[model samples]
Target: MAMFVHLTSAANAPGVRRSGIRAASHGQGSARGVYCFPVLPSYTLTHQWLRELARFGSRGGLVAVHVRLDDAQEVLVGRYAERARMAQVVVSAAEAVRRIAALEDPRGWEVFVPRAIRPREVHRVRTAPQVTGWRYLPDAHGARPCTCFGCRVRGGYGARRLRERLPHPLDGPPPPVRVLLAQVAAGDPGDAAALREALHWFSMRRRGPLDRLAGLATHPDPGVREDLVWAVAGWSTPGVTELLDGLADDPDADVREAVEAARDPIS
Candidate 1:
């Protein structure tokens, strides 16, 4: 939701000069939409470094700039300073110092620095957290994992029943719930894209004995229903599309919009 970028102490100041060079990329998967945040102390905040970070973030890198604002500076209160989809500011210097002082996970490597990008010893800087996201569904009834957008948003009574049968495990393992909550809090675009993709994929595999999505369509959760409305529009399958098309006249305005998005030629 709120992305963070951590710049190393050496490069934390706003006025620090950048070499105008690109840092070495860590391999493709290493770059799975995650950015390295450099961690530094609050006193390191310089105009040059901040400007460089803002510039880097604008180019699609998530950045975590460390800031140790006093109780009155209110560092975390500002809206994000950059406009990149893949960017964020993190107050990591304070976090790192706090954690270190508290003897918590003293491993220095926690502050990541992409190995490939350093131009020189001075250019070597540490980075930020490697965060990933996913939304979880239950294995109740031992249901196979599915991400059909149509099932998530369409189908109908049967689909809703199926979803209820396999409702999300809200209190199970902490990871999925944590990720889900973080996504909700951050309004993450990548997370949103992943959800849409997963639902679409699950929706397309339905030539079987049970219509999974048709079951989810009637899911009682208003949140689930809202998700479905968005998911159904991206589904390209004719069968799924046709099914949604029929719901265009459904009494619910959101449901009708989803159906129209699915079936309307001009949409």
Candidate 2:
């Protein structure tokens, strides 16, 4: 939720009716509150307000503030309405936009000041609701099984998404690899053989004269070393297996585990 703080001209009469904007326009305070109008081009006002709101919300700030002149017209009012709907603020939209525009903008106020504030909410954990009705509905009646993550996300199926993202022992970034990884790690051999074939192709490509990332895979950093192990583990080529077999004795346990996990042979 977003909040707003509104600042009106100090000279304006205290009894101003916000809904009676026309009355405010005819009143005596117009000359004093000129600073309350937006300094940006009329068209850019919306974009500017959006950016400011996002910046403020990202930081732990409670309220979004804008200053409004006593006589701001309909255009300003509409802009405020839009912003007010999206953000939680202490002041009305018209007032906040007007005030922010009136203030002297420091260099990089948008970038620097907001970066110091952190979001109030952190690490939101989403759990999927239990499926009580899918079983009662007819299967294969409406939507075909979606292979992409979009449907799963829409249904709030977090566990399935996690299972889908994990890498298989033999496949890399391809669909076949993703499927193999989705299979139980200990219980399948036909799927394992298919994974072996995919790896075999990957191995040939990685070892061919065109390979560029091979050098980085052998870098001294532990992360790099472990990535290399997982990357090479998915290939079926003798060259890749040979390298992993040699690296089984690597000082890093992560790298060793990756090497051993990828050593499955087709019977």
Report lDDT per candidate. 0.35, 0.34
lDDT (Cα, tens digit) per residue for candidate 2, span 127-228: 211221122112423754443321222224563454367533443334443443333132323244443443343332333321333443444565655655
Segments in model 2 whose C-alpha atoms lie over 4 Å from true places: 1-211, 265-267
* TM-score of each model, in listed order: 0.22, 0.24
RMSD of each: 17.7, 22.0
Error of 2 at 73 (Å): 76
lDDT of 1: 0.35
lDDT of 1 by residue, 1-267 (tens): 112233433333222124312332222222311123223233222111333333212323323333222222112111122312323233433453343335422222122222222222133233433232111221223556343332243454466565666654432112333343333334323344444434433333333212334444554443444455554544554566555655555566656655543332110
